[model samples]
Target: MRSPVEPKSAGAWRSQIPTGKALVPYLLLAPFGCLFAVFIVAPLVYAFYISLFRDTLVGGRQFAGAANYLRVMSDDKFWAGLGNLFLFGIVQVPVMLGLATLLALVLDRGQLYGEALFRLGLFLPYAVPGVIAALIWGYVYGPVFGPFAQLAEAIDVPAPELLSREAMLFSIANIVTWEFLGYYMIIFYAALKAIPPHLLEAALLDGASRWQFVRYIQLPLLRPMILLAIVFSINGTLQLFNEPYLMRVHAPTVIDSSYTPNLYAYSLTTANQQYNYAAAISFVLGAVIACASYLFILVSGRRRRR
Candidate 1:
C-alpha cells in the first residue's frame, strides 16, 4: 500500500533518536553541574558577598565597599603569607610532579611484579585524612621524641631538627609531597595507560631506548595530565594550612599564625575576631588561585598549539 504512509512510525523513530542523543550529554553532566553549583559557585558568591561588608559586634553591619580589599593589599602579613605560598609552589611542585611521573612510568611497566600492591601502597597515604596525616607527620618531625631523633641519637650524630625556622618550609613541603605523591602518580599512570600500546611498540621497534621513549612518546602523551596535576598542586599549596597549623601547635615558633593564606584567614576569623577581614582575604585568595589556574591552563594550551 502507498501505505497510508507510515507517518507514526517515522515520527517515533525521529523522536527517539534526538531524545537518546540529548539524554547522554545531559546525564554525563548532571552530577558535576549539581556539585559545581552547590559547592563551588554558591560558596564563592557567598564569600564575595561577605567580603563587601563590615561585620560588627555592637553596631549594625555596613557596606565597606572596597575597604577590606584595600586593607588586605596593604597588609604585610597577607603579602608575606602569599609570598611563602609562592615559594613553596616554586620548590615543591616540580619535585612532586616529577616524582609522580617517574613513579607512574615505573608502575606502568608490565614487568613490574605486584604492580597492584605497589600502586596501593603509593596511594594509601592520600586516603588518610589530611589532618591525621599532618598530625602523624608532626610527631615524626619532632626532634626530642620522634623517630629521626632517636635514630640520630643511636648513631651518635646530632639530631636534625625539622621544626627549626630554617627548615620548617621544607619540612612541611616534604610532608605534603609524601602525602600526595601517590595520588598524582595514579593520575599520571592512568593517563599513561590510556596511550595506545602499539605506539610504544612502534617506538621500541624504531630502536628508541627507554629515555628516548619517555621523552618523545610518554611525556608528550602525558602533557595534559601533567598540566592538570600541576594546577591541582598549585591550588593545594596555596591553600596549605593543616600541616603548618598542626606543626605550629607542636612547635609554635616554626610556623607562625600567618604561615599560609588559609592559616592567616583562620587567625583573622578566630584569633583576631575579624570575620569580615577573613572573608575578604579568602576572596582574594580564591581570586589568586583562579587566576593562577587560568594562567597555567592558558600557557599549557598555547604550548600544545605550538
Candidate 2:
C-alpha cells in the first residue's frame, strides 16, 4: 500500500518514538536510575578501578593487577573483622528480628493501651543519629560513671564490665539491636497492615484462633518481608563500623583500629595513607556482602518453594 521510501521516511520516525505506556516504565525509573548510576554504580566502579592499582612513594601509582585483592585475601585483620561480624550477626540478627516480628504482631493486633505512644517510643531510637546513639551508649557502658555501674555500687554488687574484651562484641551488638529493632518492627508492622482485612475477617469467621491464624495466614504472608529484613541485616552486619569505631574511645584496649572491615578500610585510608589498599578492602567487603545476600536469597527462595 505504501512505498518503501515512504515507510523509511515517515514510519521510521514513528517507530523510533515510544508512545503512551511504552515510556511509562522508563519515565518512572529515570530519577532513580540517574541517582543510582551517579552515586552507587559510579563510586563502585571507581573503587574497583582504584583497587587494581598500587600507590607508593617509590613508584607513585602503578597498575598492580590483583595484588591488593590477594593481600586482602590473606590479611588477618580483615578476616578477624569479618569473623567478628559473623559472630555478631549469628547472635544479634535472629534475636533482633524475632523481637521485631513479635512487637510488630502485637502492635498490629491494636489491643494495647496507648498504642500510638508505644509505637512512637519504640521507633524513637531509630530516629536518633547513629553517631549520637553510639556516643550515648558509650557513656552508658563506661564503668566509671555509668548508671549500671552506679546502680551496682548502690546495691553492693560488682559492676559488669560491659566494655571489657570479653564483652565488647556483645556490647556493640546490643547497641546495633537497640538502634535497628524498631526500624524492622515498623517494616513488619507495615507488611502486616497491608494484608487484606477481608482475609483476616474470613479467618476469624472460620473460628481460627489468633495463634492458628498467625501461624498459617500471617507468617506465610510475612515471608517476603522477613527475607528482605534478613538481607538488609546481613548487609548492615558486614558493614559494621559506627558502633565499634565510637566505642573504641571507651574501650581502647578492646576495640582497635581494625575492629571491623569498614573501620579497617577507614583506618587504612586516613591513618596509614593506603588509599588503594583501602579501596581494595572496601570492594572485598562489598563482594562479601553481595555473596552473603545472594546466598541468603537462594536459601530463602528454596525454602519458599518447599
Candidate 3:
C-alpha cells in the first residue's frame, strides 16, 4: 500500500523562505522609514502645498501657483543675500580648510609636545554650541568694551570694528571658522592616520622630504576627504543661520532680516508672517542645496573614476 505522500510543494517552501528573508530587512528598517516619512517627507509635502498658495488679509488664502517662485527669481534681496554668502564661502572656506589641514598634518607627524592636550583644546571650541559661539564672538567684537577692544587699547592701538556693515559678513565668517576648525581638522587627521605606514616608509627610504611626502602622497590620498569637506562647507555656507541670527542682536543695522537665505526665510515666516512665501523660499533653498550637492558628488565621483 502506497502511503499518502505528505505535502511537499517545492514552490511553497521557496516562496515562504525568500519572502520571510526579504521582509526581515524591511522590518529592521521600519522605524527609520516611518520616522522619515512622518518628519521629513510629510513636512516637505506640507511646505510644497503651502507654497502653491498666497495668504490674504481680507480674503482667505488664494492659490498662487508659481507666482511666489517668480517673485523669488526677481528678488533683489535674495540675490544680494546670495552674493554675500558666496563672498563669505569664497574667502572663508579655503582659509579654514587650509588651516585645518595644516594643523592635522602637524598633529599626524607626532612631533609636537602636548599633542593630546592640543587636540582637546582645538576641538573644545566646536563643543560650544553655535549660538553660544556667536554670542561669545559678538561680545569680543564689541567696539568699546570687548576683550579685543580692551587689548587694543592696552596696546595703544585702535580696535578694528568687526561688526560694521563693511566687515559684518567677515566677522560672521570668522566665528564660523572658529567653530568648525576642529571638526575639519579631526576629519583630515583621521584620513591622514588611515594612510599605510609602509607608504611613508617607502617615501622616506626614497629620501623624500616631509613637504614632498605630504604633497605627493598625503594630498593625493586626501582628495576624497577634501571633496567631502568642500561639499559640507558649501552646504553650511548656504545655510549661514546661527552665527548671523545670534549676532544680529548686536548689529541690527549690519545684519538685516535677510542677511542670508535662511535668515530671509525666517524673517518672512516669523516677522512678516508670510507663511506661504517663506515656504517658497525654503523650497527654493532646498532645491539649491540638492543641485549643488549633487553636482559636487557627481564631479568628485567622475574624478575618482578617472
Best by TM-score: 3
| Per-residue C-alpha lDDT of model 3 across residues 23-93, encoded as one tens digit per residue | 89989999999999999999999999999999898888999999999999999888788888989999999
User: Candidate 1: TM-score?
Assistant: 0.84
lDDT of 2 by residue, 208-306 (tens): 998998999998899889988999999999999889999999888788888899999999999998989999999899899999999999888898789
The residue pairs in collision within model 3 are none
Off by over 4 Å in 2: 1-38
Q: lDDT for each of the candidates? A: 0.89, 0.93, 0.91
RMSD of each: 8.4, 6.7, 8.3
Per-prediction backbone clash count? 0, 0, 0
Q: Please give each candidate's TM-score.
A: 0.84, 0.88, 0.89
Cα lDDT for residue 71, candidate 1: 96
Model 2 backbone overlap count: 0
Question: Of the pair 1 and 3, which is ahead by TM-score?
Answer: 3
lDDT of 1 by residue, 90-183 (tens): 9999999999999999998867889889999999999999889989988898887899999999999999988898888898899899899999
Better candidate number, 1 or 3, judged by lDDT: 3
Question: Arrange candidates by TM-score, highest first: which order?
Answer: 3, 2, 1
- Runs in model 3 with CA error above 4 Å? 1-24, 298-306
TM-score of 2: 0.88
The candidate with the higher lDDT, 1 or 2, is 2
